[model samples]
Target: MERNAPVSRFGTVEVEDLPDDLRERLAPVVERSGFTPNIFRALGRRPAELRAFLDYHDALMTSDEGLSRAERELVVVATSGANGCPYCVVAHGAILRLRTKEPHLADLVATNPHGCELEPRQRAIVDLALRLALHPAGFGEADLRAARDAGLTDDEIWDVGSITAFFAASNRLAHLFGLRPNDEFFTMGR
Candidate 1:
């Protein structure tokens, strides 16, 4: 391991030293983002788990989902913020900014969705996401009804909850692994 590389509590795997399959998976992300996100490098230590993580991530966050790409990223940022995972908040916040094309929106959403200038739909999405993230047992049918009232289709509501639940696990893993946000993420959309 390089002395200069960032190390989580469990120690990180350098991208270059990663298995061919893992490096191949990371190539497009590095190509598009101009750097390997630390999540990939750090958690890439366990290639199997990392592959599984990336697979599920790709499945959920696509534009083809009921949520727009920006909306998906918005759910990630808000849920990460509420869950106190700075890694996801910073990384996905950058994505949210890029997708939404609003440089400051991510910051506001990460800090406090209620304090941000969210449209009604956006508010409803994040509100439901946060509720699920912070208090899943309380996420009753009333919440579902509220989501429907706010114009979220069944698919959109499903996506919001799924995204939030996924990020909840992601956030906990970040904490477990002592993951940190890469420096590249801070200024990505700004």
Candidate 2:
């Protein structure tokens, strides 16, 4: 693999080199985002995994029923930043900025969500997500109960947990692969 850009510890598979199906899948993403997120490039080495990951990610994030897009991105930002996953913080931070229309919120939440002026519901959701992401062994049923008390629906709470779990895996993958945020992510939504 020869990376067209310096986006990962491992050489990345450039879009032109990708098999037709993978190229087709990633084209719109690059068009929409104006760059390839390093995760896609790194995972593109194995097209099947990239396809599966993207499908699952879309299914989880493209929802109208549960947590709003901003909230889901919040979970990723807070956990990923705390976990030191630079790619997720920068990439999802951009998404969070777009969704919330608060350009600085992702930076604030990622660095210190507890210090951010979150609504009671956002606070509860973030707290529960943090418990699961940063300290899973200590997570408990009471955490879910607290989220319920804060007015999260069962489905929304489920979204909180599932989104956190999904990004935990993504964060780990970024660490293992030394995935770097595409430079475009730094300025997006700002």
Candidate 3:
């Protein structure tokens, strides 16, 4: 019987290749997640930027903020979908499914907002995130008002915008580098 070769999704980066602080901080995440996310390895091509990126990412994603984990992942998936970033769409979509425990929500949010069985507030949040992703220049007070009307506090609105903006940057980075999603992402929590 022939043994199947393990597929490699991430490029190798030596510990010395990474900045000291980044390697330190990322070690646990890499170990716990069982794989360093492609973004981590890709960003390792530039260690300083990688460190800054991880810092900002944690601040937004892991903060005690107004957005729930599901809400933050929702913004990431919706915005990444609009940006057409398969890496983020797949990665964050998996997070959304896991956090919300709604296996099909990612596809619904990615393909069409109307298809998702979201509360009115969640719908407004996703709508605002998509607008910010696709037409950031046109985003204005009206958009903010809609989010506010959805019962999102001002800080929560800012969190939504911040998450949207971060993923926009991430989408471009992934596109520029042709980052690929890990295969595990596809079936995770589904």
Model 2 whole-model lDDT (C-alpha atoms): 0.85
Q: By summed lDDT, which 10 consecutive residues of candidate 1 come out lowest?
A: 1-10
The better candidate by lDDT, 2 or 3, is: 2
Positional deviation of 130 in candidate 3, in angstroms? 1.0
Residue by residue across 1-190, what tens digits does model 3's lDDT show?
A: 0123122224446554687887888889778767777787777877878878988999999976689988999999999888888889899998899899999888889888756788887898899898888888999999988888888899889988999999999999887777778777888887
* lDDT digits (tens) for residues 1-190 of candidate 2: 2225366777789888888988998899899877878898899888888888988898889888788888989888988977888889989999999999899889988888778898787799788888888889988888878988899999998898888898999999998887877778888899
Worst 10 residues of 2 by lDDT: 1-10
Q: What's model 3's overall lDDT?
A: 0.83
| Candidate 3: stretches off by over 4 Å | 1-17
Given candidate 1, what's the lDDT at residue 30? 90
Model 2: runs farther than 4 Å from truth? 1-5
Residue 149's lDDT in candidate 2: 89
Which of candidates 2 and 3 is the stronger one according to TM-score? 2
Descending-TM-score candidate ranking = 1, 2, 3
* Residue 96 lDDT in candidate 3: 94
* Number of the top lDDT candidate: 1
lDDT of model number 1? 0.87
TM-score of candidate 2 against the unseen true structure: 0.93
